[model samples]
Target: MKIGIGSTNLAKIEAVQRVFSENDEIISVRVPSGVSDQPFSDEETIEGAIQRAKKALETTNADLGIGLEGGVTETPYGLMLCNWGALYSKTDHSPIIAGGARILLPDEISERLRTGEELGPIMDDYCMRENIRHHEGAIGIFTNGLITRGEMFSHVVRMLKGQFIYRMNG
Candidate 1:
């Protein structure tokens, strides 16, 4: 099967690759999120993922398309970093969506995000690293590398793949 992934981010590409067989082709394409660079709500993030999946599928002519998006959401405790993944099939109009690990950001980071700063840059400054999102990400930094961004997204992809398998079998 050919799977077209919406984003060319290495982490997302690697994550999606983990769930599929070696024989299956995984194509990575750079696509827009169709939302703000930093999605502020769960609904917006999910919408972005779905839109990306549709675009990727349409562009690649693949059997399936996958989209992964990361954003921040305001919670009662504080602001949380969230990631979502979506899968789309041409035959099935309904998409299968799943979410990755969510982590509460430090007030310092949250404050900057509230000021309209994107998380990638804020995390780079806070962690004193470059492009942390493309690497371990906030979850990895907070968890001491126990849970990486790729791993988190991979889990969500696995869940979406499960849904696809069930649909195919039933």
Candidate 2:
């Protein structure tokens, strides 16, 4: 099977690769999220993922399209990290959406986000590291390397695959 990943980000691409078979052809394309650079709510995040999946499918001849989007949302406690993934196939009219792990950001980081700063740059400054999103990401920093962004998205991909399998079998 051929799979097209919406984003060219290494973490997103790696997550999709981990879920698929070695023989499957996986390609990553730089697709638009169709939302703000920093999505501020679950609805927006999920919408962005679905949009990317659809655009990827439209652009590629792959049998399946995958999209991963990470954003932040405000809650009673604080601003929290939200990650969403979507899978689309030409044969299926609807897409399968799944959510990855969510975690509250540190108050310091949340404060910065509230000022209209994007998480990627904020994290880079806070962690004193360059392009942390391509590596461990904020999840890894919060979890002390226990869980990275790639791992979180991988779980979402696995869930999407499970849904597809069930739909086919049942």
Candidate 3:
């Protein structure tokens, strides 16, 4: 079946591809609707994702349409808030919603990020000891030996995939 994904991020694409690989019947996955390169607020992210799926379905006429959106949120509580949502539409245009983990950002980094600075660039500028994923690695200079983008994205994708399946069957 042809599936249309709604983001240009290669990591998202790779995650979808990995999930689909397990189901050989899925013939293709393409991103037909992409969002702006800039970051979107939490509500905008979900709305944009839904809009993209709708647009992709209308344009591609695929068997399924998928939308993934990432957002950074702040809470009054001590925990950091970073969550992403997923939308899946069937051929009939019915949509299902899913989401990934709320990866916490350090208070200091989150404060800077809230000021509209891009995460990676901000990290690089500040010369943090952690990577973007707030992990350790080659990107560790900024992350302070925390997590890599790949690792974070992998976890997000896994959560999303599980949620997708749950929504599919639920």
Off by over 4 Å in 2: none
Candidate 1 lDDT, tens digit per residue, 38-94? 999999999999988988898899999999999999999999999898999988989
Please, what's the RMSD in Å of model 1? 0.8
Q: Residue 38 in candidate 2 has what lDDT?
A: 90
Instruction: Score candidate 3 by TM-score against the native.
Output: 0.63
Comparing 2 with 3 on lDDT, the higher-scoring candidate is 2
**Which residue pairs of candidate 1 clash?**
none
Worst 10 residues of 3 by lDDT: 133-142
Model 2, 1-170: lDDT tens digits are 98998998888989988999999999889999999999999999999999989888887878999889999999998999999999998789799999989999999999989888999999999999998898899999999999999999999999999998887788
Greater-lDDT candidate between 1 and 3: 1
lDDT of 2 at 103: 96
- Tell me the lDDT of candidate 2: 0.92
In candidate 1, stretches whose alpha carbon ends up further than 4 angstroms from where it belongs are: none
- Best-to-worst order by TM-score is 2, 1, 3
